[model samples]
Target: MDPSRVVLFKSLSKTLSPALGIGWIVAPPRWTQQLHRADQVDAQPSALDQLAFAELLESGAYDRHLRSCRQRYRLRRDTLVQALAKQLPDAPVSGVAAGLHLILRLPTAVDTRAVVTAAAARSLRVADLATYHATDDHADHGLVLGYGNLADSAVIEAVRHLRDAVEECG
Candidate 1:
């Protein structure tokens, strides 16, 4: 890969706090001028915010926070995975290695919208995987299950209801 063709966009909002309002772009030297010009009106973080974040980094607090977040999210993710596996053993799940969300790919014979509707009827919540895609060309038949804010105790019950919904809609 050519270095000139690579550009990286990074933000701490998701990892840390969105209120910090800081992000950056790394592009080849020549491309930077154009990118800067195009986003001349973009908001910049305050000097105090920058100093505070730098202190968090320098004091190792940020790293500690990241470790804590990872442990917490990992446990939640594992709970959801286990529930899904036990309740829907044949469902194909992905993104288990990392992240706060996972994708449960349904069988081709399953009607995604019907499943969503049925889940809603059962007071279970699930999203159609296609809703996240820009177009049908790249969409998959599945559900996007997010466990970021789900209570650990409720995971199994949720999966049980989800399984019932899928079975009802399939």
Candidate 2:
């Protein structure tokens, strides 16, 4: 954890919108110089976007928006967690405390792909946690449920669909 060697990179893509495509980096003086030189050849974000982001920051709109987003996401996460606990009691739901998604860990006998396929057939999209692993040996059987943008009713319905899908797979 050397401070000088560490570089912090952040973007408005996640907090604001991906369409904005504006980001910044913080690094030591040497690295900053190198990055500045590289920026000359690399594609940079549009000046209009940069100015808009600056305006948002200066006006405190960005902070207000972020606070609202955090509150909304927290409520969504809680709803999802409660629905999963009630609908899929046997399965352990993890990663609900933070982030935009929750991980539902299935029993070893349960096939993650089958559940994913079944859910997809019901118009419910879910990510397989195994696909995120670097190697097959380290993979785990689980589903990544993103509830950030989903309403409370949608969260409940999605979990019910997931539960039904898992039962169908079993």
What is the number of backbone collisions in each predicted candidate, taken in the order shown? Answer: 0, 0
Task: Assess each prediction's global lDDT (C-alpha) against the native.
Answer: 0.87, 0.86
All candidates: TM-score: 0.79, 0.90
Best by TM-score: 2
Name the lDDT value of residue 158 in candidate 1.
90
Error in Å for residue 151 of model 1: 3.0
Q: How close is candidate 2 to the true structure, as a TM-score?
A: 0.90
Best by lDDT: 1
* Error at 10, model 1, angstroms: 1.3
- Tens-place lDDT per residue, model 2, 43-161, is 67789989988999999999999999888888888888888889988889988776898899998788899999999999999988998888899657899988866776688888889
Q: List ranges where model 2 is wrong by over 4 Å.
A: none
Clashing pairs in 2: none
